[model samples]
Target: MRLCGGHSGLLLLLLLLLTSEFPPGWSELFGWRDKKVLNVECETTGYEIVGDDFLVLCPGHCVGQQPLVWGSGVYASISSVCGAAIHSGVLSDSNGGMVRVSKKAGMRGYVSKFANGLRSISLPKWSRSFVFPEASRSMAESSQQWEQESIVSTGDKVDGRRLSFEAYRKGFLSSEAKPAAKDVSSPKGPNPFQQYIGRNLGTASRKPMTTTVSPKKMNKDCNVDIAFLIEGSWSLGVRRFESQKRFVTKVVEELQKTTDGAAVGLIQFGHETKTEISLNKFPTLQGVTLAMRKVSPIGGTSNAGRAIDEVAESFFQKSAGNRREAPNAAVLLLDGWPNDDLEVPARVARETGINIFIVMVEGATSEELASGVHGDFVNKSVCRPNGHFSLHTDRWTASSALVSPLVSRICNTERLICSKTCLNSADIVFVVDGSSSVGLENFPALLEFVANVTGHFEIARAGTHIGIVQYTYEQRTEVELGRHTTPEGVREAVRRVHYWSGGTSTGAAITYTRREMFAHSRSGKRRLLVLITDGRSYDDVREPAAAARKEGIILYAVGIAWAIKDELDAVANDPKSEHVFFVSDFNDLKTVGPKLVENICKEYNALPRN
Candidate 1:
């Protein structure tokens, strides 16, 4: 009918002849066989979730809305199905019979009677299908080549002519749009100042997990990403590597335990540089773990720098808002010195703005390296790097797993989880009894107590500052004022604190805190002193109470079993009663930790009482 209005049989026959050269269902026939895409076709409308059969969707006769169906975890909507997400349901609408409702991606389903039961199944962002076989083949071949050579993946317009498909009961043909040919010159990716490296610690569960939906990105300025570059060198030995591998595995498993939206990547560098088993290779958690298995610590050169380079290039592409991000900070786990050129890595660190951290296993020192080795390379990265994967996950276990060093950093400021530290910038110090009554057996518990409480803060926006001072007959400060602005330092200091055995000098410590801490305190600052002691002080506490009250220094006393209630009351800010706590014993110190910190933070809940 083009240019000529009269319908001609010869013209129609010619058009059909041309179209026949490109079969409509050709792609459907070869898609799965050729590994073009996970070819999925539903003889019944709705999704046939992976690992699920008979998951069908058809309209319900209900007067309210369309009916739903559940096969696996996915649900579907099959009312007047145009294009909307589906849900689950029981036997809904009377089908045009039990004939069967069928479906294929990109194409709608047919309800024997109704002509319009067509809808597009929502595919995961990471999951995709081809519109054409030849075009798909071309694109996939290009993508696969890029992948094989460790090249940055790319996409383009695929030719539909070569990918024509005729969707059927089992499969469909798709004409892939021709992809615009591009000359992709593989550039040497920026070296990582901060790298994310981890070995396949253990088998992570690939079972479908409920993924948390990310909030809509407001704009570019506020974006953050991070990755871990793990060292899988032979030097790690089987024993060390095995443990480290386990650590990395758990780190990944637990990452989703907290927040699924926290962008993360994993890189393993040893004798050879490979990241196929890493976060960089796949966008989905399942892809990541699948790749993780193919990985072995083969060809052993401790190329920590090479791993860093790959992470920097592969994951931390353009920065926060460019596309997907690399880690905002990178942690490098190495059993030994870097064998790659340090200057190349240093230059990359400078360019990528990645915060780099170097965690040397077996206590390898910076001095052990050749002359140019600089901790400053990773330390000075703009991304603020902290490296190490503690295979010692059992040191502290809760609902999730994480490397202690990395956990400490993540619990701090920048990305998310800043409420704990950013909401209030109060100055609070932990005063430990450290008397003979507190033995070394119970010391770790105290440190754990502080960690439990203080770790709640993310330490953002000059938010919260926590200090530690332990005293007996004599008082000594564990974490000095202004030592760590971030939560990592505070956690580290608390973990490394030295406990002393001596007489309780509660009064002397109180007096010292009031004079040295409060008297010299900055105006508008909320000074809080939390004292952990077993009982009354040797010296009179009345004087210190008056000074603290006068100075508005909120004093909270946590008594462990033998605590003196009357003396504790006097040390309180007001009726002295409100600030005082009576804990059952040191063993149960964790019970009272959150309460004490909450009380202090409550005051700053408004405008951050400083």
Candidate 2:
């Protein structure tokens, strides 16, 4: 029979009193029970309790189990019904209370901790668990008391001390029943209670009750134009399609909260591609979310490639609210394999300087994602290679967790910088000094620096072209312009450059790069020559450096160790601070690559478009 409210508790008490026999002193032991009997409505929603202590009837399944309790210094081993209630943190050991208990799906991990005077070990992920609507006020007060006394004196023999159940209960009760003054003295080592709590709670201290906090607003300085291309195919039913909309709404809500704000648009694709929200359609967060909610899924075959082309050709146009000055990005959410080709359209989109991020769910495979990205799908999408850009989830329910991470990636300013500059269309040649002074031990680091810088550009024959010239007493072209078009290809070629040892000939390397390497450079593309050396050149660099500049070569000089400042200044272009860089050791070259890329992009952006 279903039961609820104060009436249910009173009736249960009367029935128990009439039908049950009491042990010796049981009446006196439970004198406080006169206030409220156990409520039998374990399924009631929003059950309320007075003060702290009460009783709750457990669901039928929990009848034989030991009560699972967590919190510091709390103990409750009554009938399974009351014990499970206490274990769920609904009832405090101080007085007692009644609460409704509900079953929930098992968690990946459960944190066990002290509740009142009792503690429980962590349950495995597969173990069944129960939850209640709200914790009792007395439980909260008891938890506050525990947090205040979590740290004990260093002299306490808490380390590796195992007490029997009775002994441990007595010690815990005594410690909480009588409070000690706060010990402000510095701890000699880690506190034993803190360590114990950390072990059981899976954290350093008793986790404070989580309060609802507002989401973090996006950075105000980040400005970019983003297009979301979502597939609404028949495989994704209405519910999962709504999940995609909700995810996009959440991201747009956060993006619009910024001062500068990211301009976002949405395109829905199935059998055909349709622009659901134009970039200029919504001016406020509320408008964006409302518009997103109004969009209905058009279930058909997935045509992700067509949607990608739509975003590239139409969504980013000035008439559709594309900000020409801001970096462009397209996020494609695919639920299944595409009906058409992804590589050609994705490549075309990227060629227009739009960064493509692919989110694959359920039926979509990593191979499909790689085809859509058409570049470093794993690494280039985000700053680090954890596959942030190409996200995947096995189930629709878990897609909500991807929201914050996806928004952060889309708003990352550093990753967007290259899209705003002509770095993709520039011809870059690295001039290295493989002289005797630059020990062989340091040569790999120099190559690594070059690879790191090369990673920043979109390496392609029709895009940016990279060449390498290594010199000592003589010069040898390591990689000619347009020889390696892919980032991996360029990196591999850089790794294969054999170290040459002799006198420094920075000027001859510069002259050779201008005459040979720059000859392969395409017309209308910016010509950049990056010079790396550790010592002053044995031959004069001023004349050849000036000659290269006269021939329309932009020079950057990176000096390491004993390299002279005047030579670097002579080799580099004007504005020495931007064109010249120095580090004390070869290892520090890693830090200089990004700064150099930023400068390269800055110069490229400052120039008029061809």
Candidate 3:
């Protein structure tokens, strides 16, 4: 069964009535890594004990505490309640009213709700908001565009603003900040586009609507490597920026508790991508949380593609600390649609063997967010059975509540299943036209296109095997099926084959591919042939293509510049669009790389795993 849940207006209490401790995996799931008594450093004005639940009320500051609010999940404060209160009630000092507690079967604790009687309390002047050191360095140092727009925290700027801790506390405590102007709300409620417009035009501070809280379960599997890619763009705003940091901190807290633990990394990206914490940076959970709390948002455009590329190229590499044996993953917390297309880079990242989970807020449309998910894995696997991988929150603060559920999902990595040989179990052959038309200059482009297609598959004796056949006046088998045992080997061999530069004999190539490459593989793997050409064949291709199809070879015919559409159609597999492709020029071949890889992967996914 799929393991998933959502953040709602109720706290999830893990009851340990007898031991006065959490259930297995509870401490990790709830971000309860710090075992020391949280020094809220405030006077306990009142105390109540019901069963094993001990609720202590404090009058002032709580330094490091996770409070259980009636309608919210845990909040950072020792001033509220210090321990995990599985059973208890809160009494209003100003007014007396009934506090509703609803119990659900199989739930460890009850949902606590006050009847609109709990009022906001006034604070003393002596209480000042203490500023923590900035968590992460600026990410805009490398990008001129980002540097121009970045709101750098300099000279007494704790979090890009000179605000007392009292103000920061009040900002989060206030149920509703200055009623959003009538101009900001629509008949349907608050306008979603308000954040973008208000940010760019410098409108009045539109505080994110105070959100309700919620809760989750626990998972202990530690054989996973996760990297968090967060958007630190200006659009996230200062409050949201801090909220994102908190969410990340909680995830780190939870993941660090497993045996061996999940190796975690952090990447913050705006107009540029910055690696805030490398996967191997901090070996312990305490070190990870401490680093996370210091990360500040470096405002700029959200360029998720570049950030994805950075993770794919660097973060997961062995030299960069990624464990080759673990399942590699990236939890992308995106705020908006990237400035560039994510399809290619994301596909490349997936091809590199890292699973991607995209968490989009209000910034991008569903279609845009879905586009970045590797292999539509969000809909197919991550969100399988029920939950959604693309998490959408009403506002940024609410995103913090997602930490528990997100951790739960990630820890239950076993459930995030995929076919073992999803890209393996395939015998793929490429038929290329290396005539004078595709001169030495354009031939490499054709070869590069073939290389691009070859790069996405797993190349090994027992996995997907690759072969290449070049055709002109004479068809020559360049690489036999299952010959190259690695993608690097296949690519280097393809790159080394000098252009034949002869007459076009496409039919002969098809006949040669069937006779030389198709039947040699007795592996029962899916047979796929990609036929690429720039001109019509000197001989008929129909019979040769038919013979290959009769042998159950899935043919994909790609036509460039001078290649005839009719001949291309006759040569490709039935259901034309799925198998036939036409490109205007050899240079434009790179544009179709993602689509070709995706189609091939789709077919791979359809088959059973080896």
Best by lDDT: 2
The reply for model 2, stretches above 4 Å from the true place, is 1-420
Predicted structure 2, TM vs. truth: 0.37
Residues 1-610, candidate 2: write the lDDT tens digits: 5558878655544443333222223334533233222333222111122223332423333312223332212221111334445545566544444343433333433444433223333322321234555554454344333212221221211111211112123354332222222323213321111110100011111111121223364344446677898878886689888988988887776666565566777999987889998766766556667888888888887777778767654576544666533567788886756766676556545534577788767764676555454433323332224464578887777888887777787777455432533445689999988999998999999999998788767665445789999999999999888898777799899989999999998898899999988987776578999999999888999999999999999999999999999999999998999999999999999888867886786566466321
Pairs with steric clashes in candidate 3: 62-78, 62-79, 65-77, 129-165, 129-166, 134-294, 135-294, 135-295, 136-294, 136-295
lDDT (CA) for every model shown? 0.46, 0.61, 0.55
**Where does the lowest 10-residue lDDT sum fall in candidate 3?**
194-203
lDDT of 3 by residue, 122-199 (tens): 111111111111111121123223222211112221111231222223332332222111311112321111110000
Tens digit per residue, CA lDDT, model 1, 464-519: 56778888888888877556766667778888898798988888898887776555
**Count of clashing pairs, candidate 1:** 62
Q: Model 3, stretches more than 4 Å misplaced?
A: 1-422, 607-610
Against the hidden true structure, what lDDT does model 2 obtain? 0.61
- RMSD of every candidate to native, in Å, equals 22.6, 24.6, 26.9
Better of 1 and 3 by lDDT: 3
